[model samples]
Target: MCEHMRPASAFWSFRENISPSALSVTTDGKHTVVGTQNGLIFLNSRGRPLWFNKKIRKVADVSVSTKSGKIAVGSSQKVLYLVNLKGEPIWHRELDSSVIAVSISSRGNLIVVGTDLGKLILFDGKGKKKWEVHLSNSDFPVNSVDITSDGEFILAGTDYSHLYLYDSNGSVLWSKETGSAVLKTCISSNGDYLGYLTSDCKFSFCVKNSRMLWENTFDSQPLWIDMAQTADFVSIGESSNKVNLYNKSGRKVWGFANESSRMGVMASGGGNVILGNKGGIFNYSLEPYLKRLLTGCKRSIIKATEENLDVTESRKIYDVASKNFSNANFSQFLINIHKARNLAREARVIESDSVPSERRLERNEVEEDPIVPQENTEDEMMAKLVQLAEMREKGILSEEEFIMAKSKLLRI
Candidate 1:
């Protein structure tokens, strides 16, 4: 059996002040954008706060294009804002009805939005309206919508349970009915596949031929569907704590069902899945064919420490060390483990106690790379470990190289 590595889950690298119920999150496995009651928060890859704005309110939904750097925020007040990474709105427009759903194309040229009043509108990246239409000549608010990477095909579901595929020119390609209210829907990155869930628990997928490929019912209704650019996996975030994973052929591969009812922040990566919630974010490798890890943080203690960011996510991995220390028979190893845990907890307190000036931080802003580290910390050991893990994930450090470095750290 492969040896257990460090804990698979940790709080995102830094910062938090999120109000759980009012937050909407979206990620492309790299950058994450969060929509709150009065503002939107953007984060770099390591979860460092980059910028936020207090003007946008009641964000109904948000979308991020992985290939393109554009971010879209749809508000319930009949407006949508197209913004860049700097949190500056490129443009904002008022729609015909309250914006219920919004999506951005990969090329960042087209955006599609569904209204609560049965209207669908398409726009260019500059927030200029291209076309608008009311579905079925009546009020059947569009529920969910997605655009292909090339802006060619648009998939939208409405309150009347109708699904329509429209071309960029506002021409209908085809339409179908789910026999119940459509809850959520999404299109694959290449625009070849479309999948959706309905009010009756029906989960279905279709191919480019406009033919139904497969359909099934779920015990728990899905709240959202996520399909990333490179992976063939489709993630179904259900109302239950479960997030189900399925292949393109509609086969069940695996799932993660920990924490709350929603998989609030998600991104798929090389044979693995990353999830974030009110508690924090975690990175897990699916071992077996693809499944993984071992490190527990007595759930009650974690729940209790939820508000204490200084001790929670950032110090979580040390909980594993805590467990290991208790059973260790060697005195020297136990001393080191105890010392390491203390240092880790101290690191958390130091991190949480400090705040960066938003204006001053812009000078450190990365215009071209979001994932690069901008600063260093006082803890060299932890910093080195984080660097090693990043290198391993990026394939800069081989498994053997990582194991060698990790073993040395554990010895300390």
Candidate 2:
């Protein structure tokens, strides 16, 4: 059963049997598509159902091609069903295992699928296999796959606690270790950032080079996260039945909670945010909520470095405050300022300790040649020195002349 809560002004409700495993609301808001656990497909709006899938098993996931009007449904039986807007199946293909997820490239020419056995398959728009990569052994399952908007690279999240990146030609570029099982991942429309949620329920937003831009941990497992291209913000929905909005800097802006609903934030469009839950579908306007939250006293905590400190001994003194402040808010601010000051003082101490001493010898004084030639040419004198040294071994050279030539060579 599905229940829905639309905007108070719209008063729309959508009812369905067997909970939806996945939901994709069209960009135009003219249609919403849902895939159910019973292997059924439904298309509906505020009023009634427009179409349904005929050959139903469990539908693992669904994707709608905005440009081509093609709806692709992946099934637990390892087959993908492609249909037109009218719910007529156009093509179907079988795979080695169940299809867990699917995504269409921005141009809608390629579709990427993540299989149950950690395989990433690429298919053309006509439902022909382009290439298939077995990312891991059968022990691992791929949870999600995403392609950059420009189709330059592909990213896959695996159950073995790793994320794999592949170039356009299917060459492995790089892989990163994540904290836990990666549940879902999404790339921004502009292809500038990628966001992912781990099994531990933490979210990481990263740039192209794998540098983490921001990371946020939730008290409950995150169900889904989405980003907006025009704004430096992301919306995250957690299993605790709360939706929290975060700025690009990783600060929580606002949060809404619905205790009775097992809800998750899906996609935001046309200033309206869409959410899915056991109760059904819900939409909330963003303008009023964003304005009200931004106007409030929404202070964020940030780590401060020594260069950030303006006052002397600020960090040392702030360390003192950290031990004393009973309130977390006030203590964090003081700690940052103190950290900066302490860093400056330490830098000054190091600079003073690095000063050179005046008693050290000059470069020329430490290296001087002999003051005079002893006997023959410079080479003969060295030969004579060697002969005298050998004679001294046989008791031939006198001690005084040997000392004299040695002193001359030593410039003594």
Candidate 3:
């Protein structure tokens, strides 16, 4: 992928490392809310700090209700806060254990909270408890939870590497095992796609009705995370400070790496992308043309090595010849080089063999013809042409033979 835009000069500087937690954006995209390890809530805009929570004990997760103007924050202190847009607490509730995850329905009428002990609490718009489900056995904790955009299902990730899907009526729909603990998950606006980041640093997105749509495994664990989706693409982030962009077809589009270890924020509006890290917030104009060029280059390298070229000289010839061609023509070049190289290798083997001639061919005749009979003019010329062309293409033929064969072929 091509990075056409440079990092913007705008940036937010934090006094300390951003604690491992979830980050969220308001529905209007005007403000961002993040939870800190020390139970603080921070609201930021354009690399500028807007508000900070002073009294909230270390918040573990936070989510914004797009329709109701409510912000739900969960803490390890076994408390959940329902705050308004101005960051004022509207209500507070205690869970049986430390709250690990929280998500608000799009209409803001419902709030779902997951506890470290694997219990789920559902509250109505007014903070009244509607239902609660305990998933804790002897072995797992509720790692994360997300409600579908249409309020049809509640998706939860567990510490034991499994995902449980529950209908709005609190019925289990389906469950699937992941490679590792699922760290985070996000569903698309239309409710047809779901994306998740795993503890193993692998990101996977799939259609809600089927198996995996696409997955990417990384070398480092992801920290703060968010995803942007379009009809054709999805972009994900890592706490190690990188943004991995992917196509809807499950291909990697490109990636942005941050040199600074600061937490990075990502959001998309209209067609523009906003990236925030320690350096600042930058608005990047998407460049599809340049991205195509880079993606083409990457595909060429992958296709070049897919076939076995060692069995034939043609394969070797095409492999070497294609390097000089334009990136788009590399596949054809590879084929040509392989054919030429194979032929040359066969010719060498034929010439190296020492064999006695048939009794029909006298010693004198064998000496006169060498490899081919001198009297057979057409056959001799064709043999010479093939040899000369092969050698010249391989950079082994003399200038004289190369020119002679060229003249002969042109005359014919």
Instruction: Find the candidate with the highest lDDT and give its number.
Output: 1
Model 3: per-residue Cα lDDT over 1-412, one tens digit each? 2342234322333344455354666543456676776554445555356666767778877888756788888889999888887778899887779998888887777788888887877887688888887763533778788876456778788887877777677777777888698777666555556777788888876666535655667667765444443223455655444555554444444555543444433432212234444323433333432234233333332322342212344344544554523342322332343344334334332333322121111222222212222444553344444434444555554566467545745465
Task: For candidate 2, list the clashing residue pairs, or say none.
Answer: 3-279, 3-280, 39-57, 314-338, 315-338, 315-342
Off by over 4 Å in 1: 1-17, 20-28, 263-412
Q: Count the backbone clashes (under 3 Å) in each candidate.
A: 6, 6, 23
lDDT of 1 at 165: 89
Which digits, one per residue and each the tens of the lDDT, describe model 2 over residues 1-412?
A: 1122222332244644447677665544446667776655554555356867657568877777656787778888899878777888888899989999887665667778899888888887789888888885554888887766456777788898888777667777778889799888876654556788899979987765566766778777877876653234577776536666655445455556544334343332323345555646555444443333222211101111322423335444454444433222222322343344334433432333322111011101111111111233453344334433543444433576456545554452
TM-score of each: 0.63, 0.64, 0.61
Better of 1 and 3 by lDDT: 1
Q: In candidate 3, which residue ranges exceed 4 Å CA deviation? A: 1-21, 37-39, 42-44, 136-139, 229-232, 259-412
After the best TM-score superposition of candidate 1, give how far the Cα of residue 368 lies from its true spot, in angstroms.
Answer: 38
The weakest ten consecutive residues by lDDT in model 1 span: 359-368
Off by over 4 Å in 2: 1-11, 44-47, 229-231, 259-265, 268-270, 287-412
What would you estimate as the lDDT of candidate 1? 0.60
RMSD of each predicted structure = 18.8, 24.0, 20.0
Residue 327, candidate 3: C-alpha displacement in angstroms: 38
